[model samples]
Target: MIRTTATLLLLALPLAFTRPAAAQETPIAYTVAFPNAVHHEARIQVTFAQLPAGPLQVRMSRSSPGRYALHEFAKNVYDVQATDSKGNALSVNKPDPYGWDVTGHDGTVVFTYTLFGDRTDGTYAGIDKRHAHLNMPATLAFARGLEQRPAEVKFELPAGWQVASQLRPDATKGTWYAPNMQYLMDSPTSLGPQQTRSWQEQDRTIEMQVLHDGTEAELDSYVGLTKKVVKEAAAVFGELPEYDFGRYTFIANYLPQTSGDGMEHRNSTSLTSSRPLRGPAALDNLGTVSHEFFHSWNVERIRPQDLEPFDFERANMSSNLWFAEGFTQYYGELLLRRAGVYTDAEYCTEALSGIVDAMLTMPGPKRYSPVYMSQQAPFVDAAAAIDPNNRSNTYLSYYYIGAGNALALDLQLRQNYKTDLDTYMRAVWQQHGKTQRNYAPAQPYTLRDLQRVLGEVAKDTAFAGQFFRQHIMGHELHKYDALLAPAGLLVRPARPGQSTLAARLQYNPDSTATLGTTLLGSPLYVAGLDREDVLLKVEGQKPISAKEMQKRLAAHKPGDVVPIEYRTRNGVRTAQVTLQQDNTLEVVPMPNATRKQLAFRKAWLAGKAK
Candidate 1:
């Protein structure tokens, strides 16, 4: 059997490439066809010159970058077979967790599997080749003995289907080749009919690819947001140099079942949503689009070292996701403002809306310790906890809490200098945002790097640079209402009067369980209880009255231990947890803050030029 030398991309930092780039030349072809819907299940065949040459071994990737999870795409591979050049049977064996060996074969190894392309979210294989989402979550099977880069994949088209992923150059007759491993890995391809549209603005040309089920006319109106996005993100980078820069937006529509989220790729992004692109859908479309668009700068080009040349086997975690996601969170909203697409009232209302959610979530300082949040993300992601007592321990999403941090910091900076966040905002991109390709080659930014950069801008502001440690790094939230009140702004919380329990208490997510655990220091938490712990009965009374429950719990002083039964992952456990007061952030209407604080709040928000 013959195997080819591997090739790579210049500046492609992470991949391990083989020497000489390209050597042997046999045809390698793979065809992923969707016979029914968007789900994919297909077979792959590799043809070389020999009978069991003892030269090839294959393995699948553990996961992909950007998306933070371990999704073993190769789990679906089945019914593998090998044959000699003359079509004789050869022996094959499973060598490791994700590795397979074809020993008694000299020519070809054919792998067939029924890929479950059930959902449109994440990655999936689907029907008609015309309606499939490309490469995401699909197996990145590697020839173990060969370097990770410089490999090839040939496509066996069904005559009517067109190749969709980024793989190029079809070999002599039957094989569709990837040429290099970098191309095989990063360049995503699709196999089906793609709906597309193009429009030009100034020096940039904007094009969008819509992966559809043939009914796509409804999206024609949604293309308008792309121009707005291009303009806004370009402004953040200072300019959208047409000749030097360009971006391609991909809209992957699973029509009836849309994921409603946009994930950014290097040059394109993948999105799934059921909302109509024009009317009410436009609002959500703008948001998801804006977020992913911002990633073009924050993640795609200007990113953390771990992100670039990323490890596909597992997640690349960084505390800086707060910077990557939060700043983009801040900007996703700012883009609307910068484009004049959102009125001041709209922008302010949007900003106000988030504070309410964050407050209810009450994510505190401990959420993301300075040590590592991203590294522990898979285990601690929001999905894992059905109910949490102190969401702070859960490390509220950077999208929400972190965004709040950005707003809060911006307000503090503006209040200090009577200026706005944009002043220091531009500093992030210029001093730290997008400078080069890979972060490892250059100096990586630390939390201190961020502190120094923002500190220099806040030199004269009312806030001290050390405040970043207090609020940003420390997760301390101040009563921002006082700061905003002076500017005729007031955000009052809906009242939660202490009343009797009218209903059995249970977590919103896990109604089946009772007496859920509240975080330490949480009013309910400090009162003694942990998450997943059921309050079988309040004070031993089943269906206890709200009044009685409140009276009993409220009457207890901090450090009072209360009996409780909880079913932990291990088994049923009972304990008396001490009640304690929590240090949750509060946002009472601060109509009484000093004039300077109010000015800072308004200016910082207003100054954000998107």
Candidate 2:
């Protein structure tokens, strides 16, 4: 019973090849196929040359690398089988939801399975007639104890499909080599016709492979702007990381067929969007690209201790998401601006949007600390299900709070010490993220580590400790107005005496307005209007729509009384609510700021250009 490898190689089909025979060789290799693209299925055969004495524990990832929540990837896998070198069947047992335990096999075993992928995002796999986007954790299965062993993966593309991934090529065509399961799982593959471009910056190479339904000229222009982003981001670290793969690939899909996401890895990022890269929607895609590119330095390597050696069987929680994800977000916009992708007005507008979301729009920060939100990421990141809890009233996304923290820190450092958050981040990169470290689960830095670094940078241990306690661990927000003073920026609320409902409203197709979340102590909250309450009438009259209610309320004075009728799960109710003056905050340029303040603001916005 000869194996299928010999026949496949003769046919020029993609084949997985192990290394030259040696002691302690790699335990596993896989060859993948796309036989039924219309059904969105991927067939994979994993051959294990060296198995443990007992049963081999092979499992699908419950959580992916760089993602915090439990995805339960095994739910998408089916048709599992195990065989020996001679193609004879072996005993396979389902021990748990994640894995199959194979026994009654010699030292060598061959496993085959089929995976169904309908979604194409950063975290999930997508297979179709045009292309196959493989998120490894969502498609591949790995043995428990073979994580340290090197692995080889080969793809049998459909017809004229070509492959683009960060995984380096081996001696064979269409095959790639990974140092270990960790690196292999972190690498996502995009196979189809692609618009590929390459460039060099310092000692590293940058590659962009896009499968977009756009012109080659548009792709080139996007790549040109992306190169500028890369240059500006490197300046923050003072240098580029010695990328292990010798290059970084931006695996992007901009067809109208895919859902949108931008996930970061050590050597590449998975960027998917339904939005095309030609019109007004193109600018929004740039933000995702820049944000994920920044992660190549931040979360991908600078290392969060809790997320190190990411677990596949359970949720991997990290409290540094505020810094890992939030700081990346802060730089995403700032670097785009620094790269000349944004005007000064655009940068301020975006920055101010974040500040307002954290300070007033989102009620999460007023009640909970940023650290608490980071800790709750396991339940909230891409979390989708039926929920009864009011997230707006109780939860603010860490990304919002963290970016706000970055803004405050940047301004405070600039005003007080003549340094900025970029300098502090560079120091962190130097200490933990340098390429030589090869950090894993036990090697990540913690909140304490951040404090230590801040203290060293600030030359004030007490100040660093207090900053963390008050701003991060504690719920107190930074003094944004005071911090922004030297930068010629001021936080101001909208004009007073114009009334507002002070609640977020979701308009349903049935012409009902449901309250989503309201600011604490605002007119909505003061009137006891709760989340999920359907608005029925305003001022004793049934409103045609939520917009009409808002327009009517905005016409009244702050002290006017408005009758509100709403329905909750319990019953219908009516109440007389005193409207509050519109107080939404805005970030504005200080008209009376001194020359020094203007200079600092320009320097902060444009970096070297200023």
Candidate 3:
């Protein structure tokens, strides 16, 4: 049965009852309680074994692991009070935006603060009567220089509520242990009544803990689908990552009250969405499961130097997130298709339209390369508030470009070298990720490291160097038409001779409209039409909608001049634009393919060397 919020809360036991600490290990202990979930507030108590010699500074993270943005988590904390082991009050000062400095604390220091969490996603914490979704970095505070210190966390849950996390269980009930602060902050905990399913994958355990409005039967089916994905994904790398804790957990909250997010960690992933476990929502959210699970190898342990020992004081920027996140995006879809969750037609449609078509048609890559997009992640990756920029015209998600590169590289290897991307990725895993090596910031894989691995896989350094130069370091997009020809696939225009408006259209019911991207080199660009230009009219009549504007433009052939009116900072204006044919592409199978084409296609899809 799906447990209701009131039922979950009724399960909570009183705070007067305390659990015993781990045997002789008095690690930094944290107690979290949700007394009034309706207020979206949580009471957190932190106890340290001893105080530092000087002023003790405790801080909330500015950035969390696996995220690139600076969240400034301290903003949500209130009613903070610090005291000694005797409960004597201590003086606390807010010296900075991210931390508090406590002084005059003898021997032991215990602090309590109320944290507000209204959003339920991978990056932030959220607590209500129904459940508590904890992203440790956002909900817990760590001492300034004791990141290596062991810690224990205990939840004062509503009666009958259970907990799901990646952290190992301690001796006490409702308590977990982390070897150090890094692990503590990296471990996210989900609390509530949940339907759980578990299976053993060889030596490692795979578990799913789900809290949703859906039924247990739905959750059971989803778990079965998840097992398929895990198997297929493991086949790509030829092995599973060393699950650090000997278990990998998928902690998901699909309640209507939760916000949507998917985040990866060393041994687990947190997936929260408003979507359910059945129907189309299942497919929609499973991609996140596949993607984050793949990350157990890619970013979690394979590691990026800049992101290592993740910075909590500021944004964690990395130029390799293009490869880190983007390649995973490619595998997310591919693995799903391989697992039979997606049919061939479904796979082809999404790849051609969503990833390929979007990347090829967007003007952002024409201006900025994939590496630049990866660098821009600090501002773009989930950094959505207070943004006023016209990013549509200037930025393409790194995931799109990265996935496109993966496609191009995969095809090129198959065509020229009788190899594929799987071989290259596996080689990387064996060398960098397999050793369970904790990468140092100074030792992260550079572009050269990637090129070297590709060269090794293809046995052709020249091709690897050139591919990296053109697609990774430079902005040259692949011509997929040539890349897919050998695999019995053809790229063609979705609509023949259809004229493009060039500028992306956002229209209101009142006929007011705004432009999103006036793509460069298109008719709109040649005609001086730009982003943020409010569409006042077209040929003296206000555009009723995007379809109306498209219909009007479709009436003319290429080279036909049309009058366009728009508003900008300079006020009303008019321009004569020459209509151009839309170049949006789609991939279609060659019904009558030659034997060689079919052979190449089979080898590519089978992930086998030619």
Candidate 4:
């Protein structure tokens, strides 16, 4: 028999338990329990022991997986102290980086931490009038070795303070349970005060509990449309999974929410949306729900090879985050259309916007491939402008670019099989979803695996096979136009590159005869050089890629005369076009689509058909 990799081994404990202890001291484990309703405040108690000797270390996560931003949970530890049976103090200090070490003895160490009702932005207890959210990363505390050992969590509610989380309640231990620390730390609770609601669909029970000060105003919207959200999400991805089927949560934090985004999870997700759940706001909520809900079928269950047995200490690299994150993003919006929550036009508009966003803006769009980015994530750092939590913003948002590539690839797959993305994705789920828990390996699937199945919807489905190599897995952008042809869509070409006088044109695709150059928008652009002028050399040096081009340009500014060689019809012409900076780049998207585009758009928007 093949030995199971210890890393991939899932204890297979229920994700959340509402029962008591297992009563097996030799095999100690974790159990979590709480009221099964919406909540605004929570009091959690965990039982465990501190090591007898040596340096005992423990810490809350500095950052949660999936949400790449750094949210140091240690800062939220209020009134934190460790003690023994006699309530004696233990010498503890912030040792090294993200952990606290117990300097003294090993006893049943109990650490009490507090979380005051202060939620603002960036996945924490941030509150404002516009929205409030129970975003915990730097807020929740945890036990060391809990991932490997079984631990339990119990919560105490104030008055009628209802409960809301993906965890279950244990009548026995009077606590909630997780198989190990991984699930406990990975999941959190958002409760206190909120309007409560629930509905049942098939075998699964869905609750649309609401949170926020303006609870009454938006309560009806969720209550009225709870079933719709459930049905729509379930339609595309089949029934909700084991833990949560049709279970969609609508949490409102009365704080002024940041302009963009939410985080999706296995059973529940957190949203920092500015709008209410009615009218246009209601529609937005539906879309958010649809996206996160579909995650149950993709990331939550049918996951990739690298993400399983997650490595919380550092970046867990995987070549398939494109599938885990990118494809899930695709299905999130697409599920909305299948569920009738969004129109095809709306879906197309959202999908196209992302594709367009990736075409430009990102400076390193051509520098690193998706697989390289995913694999190198552990060793890379995000630039200041790229990722907010990044010590140095060097990399870009993997979700946006990676998924955009997936989008282009999906389109290619559809065209190859003369089918759509839905067909290929659903099949992958059917086969892999069965034992998804064992996923997260090095070779979850290969180029051929996707290709063989893609041909199911069409006979000559060789396009995606070529696409993965020539574009997605490589440097070139996948053939978007060719892929969209069968589906009757277009990738709307991006505006041409522009340069300044001092900045020599590094590379300009020789598509158009007219040297496509824009006025020097920056100090480099101010130089009289136009874009695509076919630079033969720079400062008497050979011109290469953009990085080298930028490096050469940064060395000189306006009024600084520099030697430049241009490949004009007049042969290599060297001239100094007075250097001036013009920092302007035009980026725009067109709302153009053919009848077929409109037809499929309608089909996707009308929600999934029954």
Q: Best by lDDT, which number?
A: 3
| Tens digits of lDDT, candidate 3, 1-610 | 0000000000001123212332344688899989888889999999976556777898998887777778889999999999989999999999988889988888677989999998888888888888989999899988875665668889888986899998898765658988666677778899999788999886789999889998888888899889988987888888887676789999999999897778887778888889999998898788889888888888776766556556677887788877888888888888877777876567778664567787778778877888899899779777757756867768888788888898888898878887888989999887766764321122346678888999999998998888888888899988888998898888888888887667777887879688776666888778887777888888889988877777887788877887888898798989987888888878877889899998887666643211
Please state the error at residue 503 of candidate 1 in Å.
11
lDDT of 2 by residue, 166-256 (tens): 8888755557987777778888889899889999998789999999988888898888888888888888888887777699899888877
Instruction: Return the TM-score for candidate 4, rounded to 2 decimals.
Output: 0.69
Model 4 worst lDDT window (10 residues): 1-10
TM-score of 2: 0.93
In order of appearance, the predictions have TM-scores of: 0.73, 0.93, 0.92, 0.69
Two-way TM-score contest, 2 vs 4, winner? 2
> Residue 411 of model 4: what lDDT?
59
lDDT string, candidate 1, 237-350, tens digits: 675422212535455563655445455654555666666565555666667677766665565555555554555555446666666666667777777666666665576666
Tens-digit lDDT string for candidate 4 (36-61): 22232223333456344566666766
Worst 10 residues of 3 by lDDT: 1-10
Candidates 1 and 4 compared: the better one by TM-score is: 1
Error of 2 at 275 (Å): 1.1
lDDT of 2 at 485: 71
